[model samples]
Every structure is written in C-alpha cells, then in structure tokens.
Target: MRDKLLMAYRSIRERRTRSILTVLGIAVGIAAIVSLMSVGYGMEEAITGELTGYADFIGVFPAKITGTTYVELGSFTDRDLKDVQRIGGIKEFSAMTFDSAEVEYRNKRVPIFFISGDTKELESMYVEPVGLKEGRWLRENDYKGCVIGDRVANDYFDEVVHVNDKLIINGEKFIVVGVFEKASTLYASDIDPYIFLTLRATKEALQTDEINYIMVRVYDIEEAEEIAEEIKEAINDNHGLDDFANAMTMGSMIEMMGDVFNIIRGVLVGIAAIALVVASIGIMNTMLMSVMERTHEIGVMKAIGAKSSDVLSLFLLESSMVSLVGGVVGCVLGAVAAKVISLGAGTALGIEFGAVVKPEVLLGGMVVAMVVGVLAGFYPARKASRMSPVEAVRHE
Candidate 1:
C-alpha cells in the first residue's frame, strides 16, 4: 500500500505542470459549485427577511382567481376585510388597495406601486418601515398626510414638498407629511417602490371600494392558521358576497416562502453544478491518459507478483489523491469568489449578504471528487490489469 502511494505520488510529481493544470481545472468547477450555492442561500435569506418584515401584515392575494392569468388576477373587496374581522378570536384587521400609479409633484412625476392602509396597522405592523431619513411617519386622522419610502421621497418628491406640502397622484392631491427610512425587501431584498395612502382616500381616487390585500392580526400568533381557515369559511357563507376574498395568517405566508426560497437556492446551485460536471470529465480524461502512458510499467509491476487488484488500487489511489487535493483548492477559491460576487451584487441590492460555504456543501464536494476519481480510474485500472507481461515488454 505504501509503495503504491509512493509510486502514485512520484508519477504526479514528475509531470508537475500537467498535474497542476488538471487539478486546477477541477478546482474551478468545485469553487463554482461551493461559492454559487452559498451566495444563493444568502440571497434566499435576505429575501425572506425583507418579505416578512411586517410581522403582523399577512399578505392577502386574491385566492386562486378562477380561470385567470397571473396578470389578470382580481382585487379583494372591503367586505372581505369586514368578513375576516367578524370571525371569533380575530382581534384587528386592515385593508390595502394597490395600483400602479404616477405621483406628480410640481413638474416631476414618478411611478410607484400605489399602496393604501387605514388605521395604525401601517406602523403597528411595521409596514411603515423602520428608518426615516427625514420628517415623521403617517399619523392617524392626519387624513391628508402620507409617507413615502426613502428612495421615492428623495429622488422625486423632495424638490417640491418639504414637510407639509401636497403631491398629486393621478391628479388627486395628497399631502407629503412623512418620509420612511431606507428599506429593502425583507423577503426578496429586491428594491420595489411602495407608496402608501389612507384606504378611504385611495379608494376614492381609484373610484372603487376594492382592496388588493387585507392584513389580519389575531389573538395568539398560534391561532393564525385556524383563524385564517375560519375566515375563509365565513367568506364562503357571506350572502352578500359577489366574489369571496382569500384570508391568510402569517404562518401560511412564511411557509410559502420556505418552499419558494428552496426552489430558488436549488436553481442557483444547479447552474454551478454543470461546471462541476465538466471538471469531472477532465479528471476522467487525465486518468485515462495516465493509464495509457504507464502501460509498460503496469505490465512489469503485474509480472513481479503484483495482483490485478494491486494494479487497480495503485491507479485508483493516484486519481483519488489528485481529486482530493483539487477539491480542497476548489473549495477555498469558490468561497472567495462567492464573497466577491456577494459584495458586488448584494450591496447594489441593499442587502448585506455574507458568503459562507456551508459545511455540508464542502463535505459533499470532497466526497463527490473522491468518488469521481475512483470511478474514472475503473476502466483504465482494469485495462492495465489484463495486459500480458511479454506482450507489454516487447511492444515498446
């Protein structure tokens, strides 16, 4: 065993540049798999945080709108909010109406997702955002006062409105009272412009009583799902209902995020996986070439009381050593690359995502490399074992 290892080591050392190149090729692939996966996982984390920031604001998408495209989904009704609040054990709830809108401040016009919420749920649910670069947040009964996110307020409205001025949304004037601090998507970390208003005012502006989402908070966080179910049933039974609204507790939304993020992480990892497969191909090629070059040596070793199994073990050991070393190099390189990618993209996205190669990914890479080495060496090892000593020695 020692002799085989020594021989394997010597062979690789003799062809220093070739061995290094071969290992490096595999390292590049390994690094990609490890680093990209880590980054993907980090992105998923960032997005989850961004989406769930409003702990109490349960998203209320129109429940499986019958026979409609994602683009054609209908809005929820105000009665839907009333129905949900009517359920027993349900404490408080609020509704939001959203539309793509253009806000005009003097000569400047900016487009954003027009979102409106009534009551203190905007702040109480943390939907108002935590940080404000300037001014205060939306106050109840300050009917005309509205708050805009940092990006929207500064870049667009700041020029016209100071603290107590009005801006126009679809020709309807609204007072710019407060500005929110910089906020990222706690769920996606993707920047989106969300402009808020009073539900009543927003409904009037849109010329309808329709709401796009309803946020519900129940007694005891654990009862969120049960309360949501009861709400759903109540909506179905409501006699005056035209199209029923969908109710969701926070738990269901969070659970949906888990499945969603897992798929995203898997996709990112899969892209990197293709690169690793190419590296494995390179490993296999190198092993086959090594076998061909050492035909005479293999024959001589076999003639000198070395069994076919010994010949197989020697080549397998060589491939394993090469891949093992390459795997380590790849892991380190990949982690550094992930960090660089994270810093460049994550920062731009306003997310402080850190690149961390999970232990499982690292270990998995090593195990895969070793297995690939052994598998790649199989045919060559068998070929070396079957050669006749006389035929090999006389050939070259």
Candidate 2:
C-alpha cells in the first residue's frame, strides 16, 4: 500500500505542470463557493444580531398597493392609534411620522429622513438599546429639541456637529439634544443618519396629523406574534379596510430575512457549482491524458505482477491527491478573498461586518473536491486497469 501511494505521488510529481493546472481548476471552483457563501453567512449574522435587539418589538405600518402603478394607500390616523392601544398584551407603543427634508447645519444643507415620535416612548423603544453617545434623549416639553444619529452628527457635514448645535429643518430651528452611538450592524435604520423630533414639534412644523407608523413593545416576547396580529387587525378595522395595515414582529422579520438570504445563498452556490462542473471535466481530461502517457509504465508493472486493482488504485490516488491539494489552496484563497470583499463592501456601503467562514464550509470544500476527482477519474482509471499488458508494452 505504501509503495502504491509513493508511486502515485511520484507520477504526479513527474508531470508537475499538468498536475498543477488540474489542481488549479478544482481550486477555482472551491474558492468561488467559499467566498460567495461567506458573504451570505456574514449578512445573516448582521441581520440576526440587529433583529435580536428588537425581539420584543413590533412595527405597524400602512400597506402599499402593488400593481401597474405603485400607490401608498394611506397613513395611520389618530383613530387607528387609539384602536391599537386598546389591544391586550401591550406594554407600550409609540406613534411616529416619517418624511424627507433638507436639513441645514452651519449653512451646509443635506437631505435627511426626518422622524417624529413620542419622545419618551421612542427613547425606551429605540434609543435605549443602542444608547445615546452624547447629551440626553429628547424631553416631552423640549419641542424645539431633537436627537441626531451618529452619521448625521459626524459624517454629513464638513464641521462635526455637537450637542446644542442648531439645525434648520424646513425653515424651523431645532437644537440637537442628543446624538446616538454608531451602530455596528449592517441593517440601516433611523438610528444611523436620521434626525428624531418630538411628535408635537413635527405636527406643528409639518402641519399634519398623519401617523406614518406605530412601534409597539410587548410585555412578553412569546405573545409578540399574537399581539402583532391583533394590532394589525385593529388598525385594519379602524381604517375599514382588510389588510390595510401590516404589523411585523422582530421574529417574523428575522425569519423573512433568513428566507431571503437562503434564496440568495442557493443562487450563488448554484452559479459556483457550474465552475465545479467545468473543473470536473478538466479532471477527467487530465486523468485520461495521464493514463495514455503512462500506458507503457502500466504494462511493465502488470508484467511484473502488479494486479489490475493496483493500477486502478494508483490512478485514483493521483487524482485525489491533486484535488485535495487544490481544496486546501482554495480554502486559503477563498478566506482572504472573502475578507477583502467584506472590507471593500463595508467601506462602500458604510456598514461594519466580517466574512463568516464556518468549519463546515472548509470541510465541505475538501469533500466536494475529492468526490469530483474520484468520479471524474473513474473511467480513465478503469480503462488503464483493463488494458492488455503485451499490447500496452508493445505500443510506441
């Protein structure tokens, strides 16, 4: 057995260039699988982490009608808010209005998502989780005060904004009462670049009574789904339209995100599998060429009492060795590629996340390469084993 293994290694070494190229074919496929799948894993981790922070929370939003033309049906009314408040298992909720406005700070103007909500409720529901980086949360009576996100305070302007800095929103002046800490997750939300105002201030500034959405925090996470359904039903009932409002619990949101990531991973893996299929063909061709080149050597061995099974084992082992080596190289390249991609993407998108390469991914890559090699080499190995010794040795 040792001699057979040594002979196989020597044969591969004898054709170093061909072996290297064959190994590289398998490497490319495995690299693609590892790099692409690592991104999926990283994204899933980021999303799940963000969602977990809101596990006991539910968001109720007005549904949009999708068809030939997109239409926002309507916003939640004060009556809708009252109906939702009456639902059981509710700990507390906050009604929020959202709009886009140009904010001017030190004469530098930038477009921003303007949000107004019940200040105290907003603090408990959203701000407390990530916490405030500076100053304090908006007070109920501090109608002229607002809290800014990390990006808005630090990144959106030439001069860094500080607490007590004044911002002009649609010609209305508001003082920055607080700034939120920079969030680590990839999921973007009001915590990043948006400005938060008290509900009364927004209503007075915008001259609107419309509530864009309501965020509810349930007492028990176990009853969150049930309470979310009730909230949706109450809103729908108030609006006199079935399914007019959608209530999404954090758990449901996470599950939906998981399904989306799963589909994306499947599509990416399928594309990578195409490269493996091409690599398998390369392996088969390489094995066939190796068998033809070694025909006389195989015949000499058979004449010297080497069994057909020994010849078959030698060819198969050579192919497997090539694939296994490729898999190792591919895993290393893939991990580095994934890290580079993750950094580049994070810089481009302004989110922080790292590529997640699990042990299974590495093991699976090696196993896949070995399986492809064995299957591809089978025919060529069998043909070499079945050759007539005299005929093979007599050939040129």
Each model's backbone clash number: 10, 0
lDDT of 1 by residue, 105-202 (tens): 87788877766776577666444445555577666565566777656666665573456667777777787777666565444222235666776666
Candidate 2 lDDT over residue span 130-181, tens digit each: 7788999888887789899989999998889989999998789999999888
Model 2: residues >4 Å from true position, as ranges?
65-71, 106-109, 129-134, 154-160, 188-190
lDDT of 2 at 58: 92
lDDT of each: 0.70, 0.86
TM-score of 1: 0.88
- RMSD per model, one decimal: 3.1, 2.8
Candidate 1 lDDT for residue 88? 72
Q: Model 1 lDDT vs. the true structure?
A: 0.70
Clashes of 1: 10
